[model samples]
Target: MQRFPSAISLFAALSFGMPALAEVTADDVWTNMQAQTRAMGATLTAKQSRTGETVTVEAQTIAWTLPEGIGSLTLTAPGFAMVEQGDGTVQILYQATQTYRMDLVIEGDTATLDVRMDGATPHMTASGDPGDITYSVHVAGGMTAAVSTHAPGEAPVTIDVVVEGGEAEIQYRVTEGPLLAIAGQATSLPGRFDAEMQMGAEVAGTVFGTVGGAESSFELNLPSDGFDILNVAAALRAGLSLDLKSALESSDYTVNLDFYGQPFSEERRWSGANHAHFSLDENRLFYDASGVDAGIVMKGENEFDSPVDIAFEAAAASALLDIPVSGRDDPQPFALRFSFDGLRMGPGLWSLFDPAKAIPRDPASIDLDLSGMVRNRVDLLNFRQFVGDVSGLPEPELISLALSRFAMTGAGTATEATGAFTFDNTDIETFDGLPRPEGAATYEISGVEGLIDTLLSMGAIAQEDALGARLGLGMVTDSVGEDQYRGAVEINEQGHAIVNGQRMR
Candidate 1:
């Protein structure tokens, strides 16, 4: 456990000797918001609302730096207001009369959120809509701040975020609610959600990097029934843990979902379990994520029109991804690996696909391992600057890519492959109108001919299509066993393609 100064202490340290203003105004609040946001490499601009005079402040665009030190972040919204209290505290509010929309982007992640709230009193009601919403903030002491949001209804909700003693805490609770407008239509959602989180050193470091190590945990629970959307009763519980150390970041999480429904007057049910653990550490200036494991399990009835039930389990899935920060002029190391234990489908489902059970019903596992080097490095700040501006922009590039190792394995089966390749900037016409590749690869596959024949006999594939597929396979493969074939492909420096030691082009 590590100790950090409270929010007040951090503020005081940053604003040492600054006088406490006797009066707080919207401008002051906006200035403070901008100052804090800028630390995260974000820009926030305010303008007049387009709706009416009642709307005082509208922040058009708020963009920030992306995590993993990559790309950019953008958040677009059309709401918010600045208000001052007699106690000199300021509040930022968001309430829309019509539809409320927020678009958020963090690197490759993106989400668009829409919400509506309705309350009974004018003070509780928001600007655009008729929902009762009360959002406010106050500085209780020199080092403590409290922010709260409330919505009154059949299923009332209250959320509070408090920052004190160098830590930020969030708490949320919602009671079972009735119907609320969804996508402009009234929809019933009889459910409740509750969650709590506390930010410590690790979380602060990960977000701001101005702090030291941090550790954080999150828990959530949601149980509901009478949901017509999926025609089922559903419940979910999840927990997550995160940590950021000097040169490493790690996370562990798990989630469980239970669902119940009726099929043909019979009760059908199922449960799903998911878990994941991963960690990333800095290797000098570069970073690598390894020892990652994730899995999922589903056991229940096939509630749909399918002819079989399901008892699937996919466990022991693991992966590794390496990122290089070497300059563009130098080739950077890159690699990726992924593997899964097996995929197990229930016997009933397997039988539905093959009544005679020609193929083995046992679980099938797959693995892929690849390692390579490439040239693709871009300045983080420069790339972010061009995210929303394309003209005269300089993007990242891969001038050269080389794969030193590539392998795929199908456990419990005679299906496997291995290969390597290299590509440079030089152009070669015989290489599919692209830069020609140099290297060779070999593959071994068994039971494929029998599977194709079985599919044809079972009316799964047309005879004409089957014949064409066989002819194509014959062009590259040599039969080595009853149902096994060996194939090799090579691309020479002179842009010639060789199949099984025979030059084709």
Candidate 2:
């Protein structure tokens, strides 16, 4: 998904624009695009012919080499025209049905993409100067891309994607002090995708899906002084900032698989809204995503001569992460959070394990929230060196950790804990070459005793095992109420493990 933005930025280089002081000419737009393409370490070739106020470009090709000599991408288009509007603006025209071919090579494998763009009324308009330009694009009939991938000693894969009613507005500006700023908004009415794969003789699969609608917007500020599209590490080190947000209305998909004459299938659907956000800067990186009301159903056959059916639903799910990206002398702040709420399994799935309905069929949930501070001592932006050899990198010193919340609830039982800790990096020898942690944490649990009893009654656990579990619980936790227990653990200043006020180490 992150690659999508980078690909859009690459295409932005080929967009046309000019200054507002004078009537923009076709030649100006073409020259600006060529220069921007060259800046990104890509080659652009095209032949131009001018007639009156229109400039026609034909046989256009753009080729870009991937970093580390890992792969390359090349796109070729038939032709297009740029018409001067005589009012400091230019109108870009495209054929009603435009076809394009893209060739890609990764590692030792190759893939080709055939793209078809259709529009009942598709058009683009560009205005403003070379330093600041605004472009608007609209495609009524949308676009479709079919990709065929071939790898050695593997089955070939083909994927087809279609997007409908697409539109976008973009703003590009050259800011002061070697910086390029870009902001854009895009929306699509609906989309569909399909993929098929076949192996030798017995294995094959197909996936088909559709999305209701989607909208996205993004802003980026990239260092232009020494910008190379292939060198993302350099851009990050030079202080790149980007913010991206997107949302989807709904989505659903179905997958079918066949293996050695056996057939299996699964269907998944998601309703309500789904949203995601990602942002990155020189100092830190952050990302968040959430979904509402999702479910899945699967069916297959097994050796028991019985058909297998399983189903589950989730009311909501969300996750968030924030971490520092650059090294700093002082500790930097970070946080992570994840949660899944209102999870319920269908009776078919539950009956397989609990045919007598001994266990409660209640919705389950889990959550975690953590924050920490750490001092980094290595330059993470040195990508090649960091990937080639990580042993030379100094270990980051843990400063503090806070588990604000941790919880799980299901099957008539619940458990939760909270804790905060600070580390002593200077006294590593006290903890055997590791930083000593000083903090206390407490936990509460309910329904464990009753659940164990029920399992014992159902013969799920032997009597001796259940007795041993009860004895272990009694040693660690004090019974606070019926079928409930509470306990606390601490790491004292002297590096002793204390459980319920008793020193254990």
Candidate 3:
């Protein structure tokens, strides 16, 4: 429904009246991509290849307009040359030896592009799949990367956003045969990355033939995710900021955020009827994400690091869930509500994996899977942590508030238990009572531990914090031996954590 200028006009403008602008960031890239696609009615991928180059794709059946914008490209590799005469025309040359491809269009605050080398394996692999991978990248509540979504009802275009340490992959079935499927994975995470997304939004996709085991994960690790959601949001139109922090094999990233406009969509809803699966491996997670809104069907996997084998439905909603504020007493008013049913998530949560103070994997335990909620409010003006109000919910979907002193719950298959005893529950058949919860909560604590020792050691706890001597042992195999003890008891529910008996969210 949006309109963009023509490419000819854009080139003309840039040829003459340029400059008088500012710097560009990842967000700018996204803003430009979306705007250009809307204008040209085309699908574009920027940063899919090396930077400074643009490539256009004519694979899908679609027409798009170009926008008016400014771009400075410093093409390198195999020697490049550019000449500008007194006139307005310019001559650029590239060494024929370097066979790369680039297509870009800039029109009125929109930039869409596709850059690729002559030969690419991953791109050729994910021919047809569902979902735009660019959507998966969420830089944890900070400046997102740059890119845009091609409008729906248009010819679906596949883009490859390959940055220094980011990769986007996706798979869809365009074969038009008995089975029409679409799925994939994406990421730009480096183990060294200490990224924390207090507020997060990102989109990425990939085609995963298999979803299990360390090898599968190792395969995924080969591909990293790039592009930040916050950065892209800022580029589209409303120039805003986002907060993001990350570290990778050889890269580290950081971004402060203040996002505006629409925060993209928040539903990881992948729709493809026959594309469903159910998996349970390491960790003690149980998920069943199958359904229209949840996903195409029930299918999930667990990292080999998990001690127990787990499986569940794909339609099952997130045990730990967040509700969108449809309407509020006051947009800036000081009240908030959060809830969860059964959450499965990554590590570093409450340092549950730490050997020093984590729980054991055996006797795997957790009962408040039904539902729970928390309703609280505070002076938004002050904006201090660990301080708020707590209202009650009629009935909660989950209820694992704290271990004893203070603790919080999250979602995921594996987490820190009391001590260490990899849950020996590979019996997918025996697993039962898995729930799709709907509940609410209202409470607060400070410096809270994810779970208790026997709570963890006796297979009671399951959280990810500073993995140490034990989840509850209060000590771990200090790798650095610097005594870098992570004595965190922070409290956080909704947006804060509880530590000790106080609030340290």
Going through the candidates in order, what is the number of backbone clashes in each? Answer: 18, 2, 189
Q: In the order shown, what is each candidate's alpha-carbon RMSD?
A: 17.7, 4.2, 22.6
Q: Which ten residues in a row have the lowest lDDT in candidate 2?
A: 1-10
Query: What TM value does model 1 have?
Result: 0.46
Error of 3 at 264 (Å): 40
- The digit string of per-residue lDDT tens for model 2 on 107-146 reads 8677776655444334566666754555555545445555
Q: Candidate 1 residues 197-290, lDDT tens each?
A: 2222111101111121122222111221211112111111111111121111222222222223222222122222222333222221222232
Give the C-alpha lDDT of model 2.
0.72
Residue pairs with backbone overlap in model 2: 18-129, 19-129
Candidate 1's displacement at residue 171, Å, is 23
Best by lDDT: 2
In candidate 1, stretches whose alpha carbon ends up further than 4 angstroms from where it belongs are 1-311, 325-327, 346-352, 380-383, 389-413, 428-433
Model 3 Cα lDDT, one tens digit per residue, 3-84: 0112211222111111111222323333333332333224333332222332222122223332222422221112223232
lDDT for 298 in candidate 1 is: 35
Please report how far candidate 2 places residue 107 from its true position, in Å. 6.8
